[model samples]
Target: MTVRRPIQRFYTEPAPMNKLGKPHLQVVRSISVGQAPNIPDTDGVNEMLAKAGPSATLKDVARGILDRLVERPELEVQVEEILFLKDCLGASLEWLCSLAASDGAACFKRPLLWSGWCSRCDCEAKDYLMIYTKQVNANSCPGTPGSRSRTPSVAFSRPPSWESLDANILEDFDKWDFDSFQLSEATKGSPLHFAGWKALGGFLGEEPSDVFLEMERTSRFLEAVEDMYARQDTVLYHNNVHAADVTQCVHALLLQFGFAAYFDQLSILALLLGAIVHDMGHDGRTNSYHANVCDDIALTYNDISVLENMHISKTFKLMHSDPSTNILEGFKLEHRNRLRKEMVEVVLGTDMSSHFGNVADFKTLIEKLGSDPAEWHHEPKAMSALRVMVLHAMDISNPAKVLPLSDKWSDLLRQEFFLQGDEEKRLGLPISPLCDRETVRFASSQVGFFTIIVQPTFTLMAELQHRVKDVLLTHLQTNTEAWEARKRKEQLGLEISQALPLLKIRPLESTELTDLAVFPDTGACLFSPSRGGSTRDVPCDSQSHGQPRVPAVQRNVEDVEGSDDETALAALAALACCASVEAQVAKGFHKNRPAAPAEAFALFY
Candidate 1:
């Protein structure tokens, strides 16, 4: 049986609803002459979305299908549902991309679902779709001819392998754009184990009594925390994956900024642990939910930083529960107390109410450091303050990520917000800002958030940390401008793709097309690779405004069957942190490369 992959949505009839109530969403156009437009130039997609239904539900179905396929690809059953959902997902994405692609007067509502759909779907360890997330703002996908055939400057191939991902990702430990979702999938929904180990490894290994024993001890603590996040009560956004993302990001920031140069090992451990367990007992709803409803946790802490206090207290209680899990057991009373105090400050800084105050305090501290660098160069006395501020930044650092990742986080956050919004509506409470599914303009809100919160805070980081200025702050600027452009184009009803120029993926200059991650619209791969290897040191494509020359990556013959069972699971475990965006550049540039191997999802009947 020949199964044609439905890359575009064809309309004639509304699709049939499956058991879950979400419509199959599209009819596959028979392979006729130009059956459907690459981007629909009408309001049909929006209409389809209204009737075809929630992309989030579709995302869940798609993921379930993929998970089953991943579990038993060898089964002879040909699931046409996979192809159907992929088409629906593609069509759903088209609606979003169409919002940017054409000049249309109708604005989309329920804006929260877009990012949730994309982030959750994209994070699939085995995604059925190949849409790269580059088009909204990064206008670097090659519209020019002969761009893919350029020669390589260096050799690079694929992101760190997903086969041994956790162990593999540590090699790229300092990269800021870690994909905790990928790692979560690899770790079987428990990313904290790998991320925590990576973040806390330095401290745990420093003059350890027994290195293996210390490793085991840290694992116990991390395991307990991961279990907490992965409790029966599921948290869509503030789960283990988010914890891992924050933890790895904190670890990366510390390394990139060289905080270890000033802060002691204990300070570093405390900070890392703070990131790991900061939201240990999060019940999905925000502190406001706990407070408004007068929940036990809210009452226990008198409704002041209720969630933050619970996180810290619960973490400590869990640590003290078993000797194996108590990482600071060997430390003296004073040292342990100091660590606990510092951790409390760090986790408390994450309270959303304290966000602006923390930023203001950090700004003041930055000024102080600037005014008298000599005094602080030797003292470093405000270590706890600095630690708290840094955790706060990392906790809200989703906007600091590159396009693909930043959007993924936005998707997760908004889903949580919308869920909260639904509860508020049911209970007759005011919906939180950016949480409402009906009235919120997500793109505009993101622009405002970037302008008001993300830019200034990261600007402070740029001033304080030189590497952030060179690497991180650059991404912040690019991401901010992208969101701003999205808002502008959306308001004007102009084609977003046309407003931006076609540029190149600069980070691919040192890698190969083996890193190609295909996008449905725009060049989605973070970038095209340069040569064959040596991509580890390469920064993301956003680091440079200058487009690099694209190169062709040719492979004669190599194994691509993809690992399964224990080996694959172990690798997937570590993928929580790193999945190179550069791999999505296949169709954008280097189109002449050999057909992708089966392992990379090059399907055949």
Candidate 2:
């Protein structure tokens, strides 16, 4: 397996960048937003003070649209389109991330000014960004992977349709079986706002009854998160839908099992908000990828829980700098601090490096609590522990979902994994586990994931909340069996392909063979009766979508009637009866495929 090899290889030392080491800039509440412009300082104002700089002017324009967004009871257009239009800052992926990280006070405030300075690092032009990353890795040069992409800054170029969301699909969002993907499609690529709205506004019910924060603030914050996860070339599994998924799961874990009843409004809101922003600005690479590559962000965070630390820091900074994104703006200072602290703690707890240990620690706590989730209410530490486990579990809980959702999520995750593997292959770094596409088996890999990570997480959930126990474990079992079945079929195809050359006898000259496909090189027939003209049901269809599914010739060649070597003839007939190595080739899997299930062995031997 190319699994451990690539993950183990190390590249050159991280180039030291003094600029990267600079302190993370904090926002100082700047010029009052939405105030009337000065009456023309030409009359009696000092020359230096009356310059009316770009920052002041840019803020004036960006803020011009802010009032409309904030005050309008609803938006007819997508928030991103309105926010990222030319009249506003016209932000790029990197600039948006930088704003969340350090440049917020300047970038968004004076986007044009910073544009000339950092336009090269646009995250939207990911091909260029990747090229620059490779050049840096190849040279071990004194530059950060992202900041020097030298690509043109792009407009947020809104993705998906800008039409209004389908209210019908969103009506079922509260259910455990709710599909975040469907929500994303319904919300025009901005489902987080609706999900976030429900988290704070609807879910809170009359908690702290008097205060009502506008959806605008919460939507802005959540939209920023969705924006950060959008990448040009990379497919992001931790995008807004995953964020919404975690938020929903956190709610179900808390409210369904009586944990929310114990926690106050603020604490519940803290956990929900944490789920919303936990993966903000995710670039789809794991922490180990960052640390190994010596990415600028990793260096800034000291290579320890680098992505987690960056997510919370940049995200909170986004909230701090923009009133539109700061949902906690009017709360009591102490309440804000408490919520922020808990949010940060829970987000940090999502890093996988500490996953098993955290799970073990939480398991120990569960043992102490003796299957009672209500006991967590009295134990503050236990409550905190529960919060950590819930988010971490839901964050990785796709496997515990129904077949299609799990399949869709797995496909997305593999896209991300292979993207990283592609980079690792280029940089000569060891490919991390499950990242290498050429060597990894899609179906079998998930079976191990189910065993190691997925099972334990839901087991803990079952221990904490019995209501969800059957659904969670049942989905897990179904998904596991489906993958196992797929794995077995794939193995049969592979083994048959391997044994083809041994059939040294002349190829069967048959009149009945209608549409049997043969390898040009091997002369082995690949005949899949099930795949005959139509696409199969998908939960990771082993057959590549590229394959022609139209019905081919159909005939079963069984034990060549009077064959002298009966066993050989029988093996050949069975081998010729089904799919083989071409299936793997069609799916773009090369080099090595996994071989585990023994059921395939019984067929030919």
Candidate 3:
């Protein structure tokens, strides 16, 4: 008979052979120790043994390999674990664990764990690993790592507890100078993260533990926010600084009117988050520019609120891109859905095109709720409308800030507008209003923007938040006056340039001479001794003067040169009226009775 060695089958290493000539199943020794001894592979014998008894088969070996793989500390195992957890606990809890893992919390203490017995199993059991947090003045569990047996001897200053935040704190918000809260000084690189944490802790009355967890996700979310705004496409103005400014302003506004008390924690969260991300990934261009150029963003959003839609959608996409930054990680499915809806609404409301409609809605809500604070406190829809309005107000509040702050923001905004104008010129597109730096006066543009947009928006806001009326109106008036003063200064400079040639200090250049024909009555032929020019005179009533003639009124050259700016302006005004009268006489207007200088001055002024 031919002798053939028994095949090793699935085992990589050969099993030890017993004296009886049967192979010992070394891999299954622990599990099948109490089972029947291994038998030789014979057709009838194997079938009889398989039918007769339960044995460790190829299935047992495969199960053992899978269990070991799941427990291994490898990237593959981590990916598998994530998929498994996601399947077991659904997306929300899985997201929370993912963020916790990124924050080092899951590394030290497994985020998804259970120490209690399973009701279904009815036996003593442990699922995953338990987290043992260090506690002050608490005894350490014997086997727990990083547990404290005693409180720390050193005292530390902690943030105020939620219970300590009262009406007094809310009332004091109006006095707080928001400019003093610089993100560079306070948050290092994450102002929105800092603002979100403080707003939740101080205003929403969240516990320290809850705030700490929320901050983990907020920090992650802010990472994405920072990255998006740091891209090459991002411009100078609509960046992280602007987002932080709006967030801080929203927080202040919430406290200003006690909206914190009126809205729930979720609503407040949405409002603050909305402010922080309302302008996310702004390309420093307006929606009109996008639509006019048929840009991808405009086409995607159907050319309506293009930038706003892009900002909000990109924000949510970043929030889901990583587990670490998912701000709504642990929220219930319904709450998460609702928060997203509300946040999108609030962010979309920031579009300037929707500003008046949102303000009108808010005003109608306020009217329905009545002027009483008590009545306004309980209506959810009204409070939501107010929240949207508050965020919108904060978005546009930069121009209403104090002079120094507003001027800085205005300069940055003008630079951005000029850049767009440059792009438009390059593309042969019509330059947008207030975008052409060569033609548009910054101060005059600001005056129009303030009067047409900023003033009316804030006026409505002031009316709604009565306590902030004085503060808002004060800053609005101050900023408006500043812009108006700048406009007047600019206008005065232009008038001086136009009047310079009329003074006739020297012979007119070609451009100046051309300007002279338009002002026939103001074309004087007085020579300047200071300029070493010979004296000449011209009659004001002459239609054309080929040669200089003596004027009806003569003044000393020394007196004219020594006159103040006000005197020069007055002379220009008088000459302007004279030209107006000449033109009217030429047209047979007021022909019978020419108006006097005083009457013309009154009409012109």
Candidate 4:
């Protein structure tokens, strides 16, 4: 039977009830549209919003809906009702309706759900909706493009096989524009920016002119690094896109937390500029790669994380190569040294081997800051400590950002390292434990590395730098949990379970339309169901008007027939796992990629 799904669209509808029991009708639009007209352009919502004042519930709903969906459209499907409510009630209500709308707005709009309510409560339905909305928002936040739970890149093919995802990573490497980045984007001219801008102005000790120029210089450096980092072989699994993401995160932290006032323009510029270049010469091999076979780049830096340090120095040198591009040229000699030292400290801090000593020193400094908030001075040591802590945390911040993202990164790095180990085997070289191609359960060691090395380091730094406290703490908690959780899974033999396929997917790559996942356990290959199907088993039924519900059953390929049970189930499970992983990776990739016209969402019928 052909079932017509409601086409997501915008329309003028009856005003929803406001808190004041006032009549309000609003123009409701499905968020799938590419560009949203001004709320004022919507039928009657803006008129009341203006009359109600900015603090009015109607205003908040109108403003919040527009702001939330500006970057993400998938959210509309999840919160269509809330958007609809805002469209209708925002025009006439002043109190209860507004309050309910605000609660929904906050509950549904967070990046992730942090709490859950009792399942049996009368309001449980609303609570569950909120929880579900939180998950949807978290899974669908702006920074993470395709991640449902921040898993690494995975791929699925009609017949799955291993393929390198380097190209896919490169394509998405271009999307991040340094200058356009914001810490807290409330509205176009919101009070958030005004305060941040003022803080930055004060921090720089110069008015807008000099500070803006310095930012421009910083942006140029970031752009160049993006270009260089995107080249083949520079990044293996953790590539330029990862660099861009971390940079953006750091940039956002600086703006969001109002750190701009504490440090000077040189300091801010150094942190940002250094971030772009820090990983430029990374070869996917750990620092141990320094001791192996006199790597060409290693030879140049005398094996002291020479590649990273050189990346910093080379980036600056390149900047100075062209007079027009020379950001340091305009600075006074003392200022140049200050900028150089700050940049050096930040870039050098990326070395994971020295993370303990570095973060410890930073923690000591934070301890020294003590209870006096005003005693802070602009000393090189002070700036260096703060800058290093931020860059260091950023370098290792991936796992802490989200458990799935961290685990995925660890998986990819392990894969790439082992791939290198495979090359070693082919070349008659000794295989390293984590790096050896012959190694099975390679992820085991990475879990340890994350626990012992990566986790503690970032946790300490987060304690020191409040700017990324939320981001860092989240990562740390998630990292520990992921490790513990993965261990539990390993104990259950779930790690080796063939419930999911092992697909090698890349970020930001166009997937072939014909490829689909097939689960071996259930013999259920992916069938693109165009219409809603329901069963009594699901408590909250999303039922269509006239369709009869199908009874729940356990069968092999009953829905999509003509496929063998074992083969199809294996294929389906493998494909599903791969697809899940791929979707997560795609989000990160696209987020890092240069902005282009949005890719048309692929639909299955």
Q: In order, what lDDT does every prediction score?
A: 0.55, 0.55, 0.51, 0.44
Rank by TM-score, highest first.
2, 3, 1, 4
* TM-score of model 3 (CA atoms): 0.58
lDDT accuracy of residue 258 in candidate 4:
41
Task: Provide the lDDT at 438 for model 4.
Answer: 44
Q: Model 2: C-alpha RMSD to truth?
A: 22.1
Q: What is the TM-score of each candidate against the true structure?
A: 0.53, 0.59, 0.58, 0.47
Native-to-model Cα distance after best TM-score fit, residue 227 in candidate 4, in Å: 2.4
Task: Give me the runs in candidate 2 sitting further than 4 Å from their true place.
Answer: 1-164, 203-214, 231-234, 256-258, 493-555, 558-605
Tens digits of per-residue lDDT for model 2, 1-605:
46454211212222222233433223222232221111111111112112433233333333333444345626543322221222122232232332221121222222121111112221112211112211112132222222222222222222244234454554455456778888776676677765665555332111121133333455566677667765324557867777877887776556445555445656667778888888888888898899899989989999999989988898888887887777776678887788888899899999988889998988898888877766567788888887787788878888888899889889999999999999999999999988998777777788888988888878887876676677888999999999886676555455456654532222222442334444332233433243222122212223534422222223332322222222322333433323333444323322233322111111211
Tens-digit lDDT track for model 4 on 451-565?
A: 7777666555455455445666665666776676545434323322433333322211233223333444223234322223222232222342222222222332233444333
- Model 3 steric clash pairs: 537-549
Ranking by lDDT: 1, 2, 3, 4
Cα lDDT, model 3, residue 120:
13
RMSDs, each prediction? Answer: 33.6, 22.1, 22.9, 25.0
TM-score of 2: 0.59
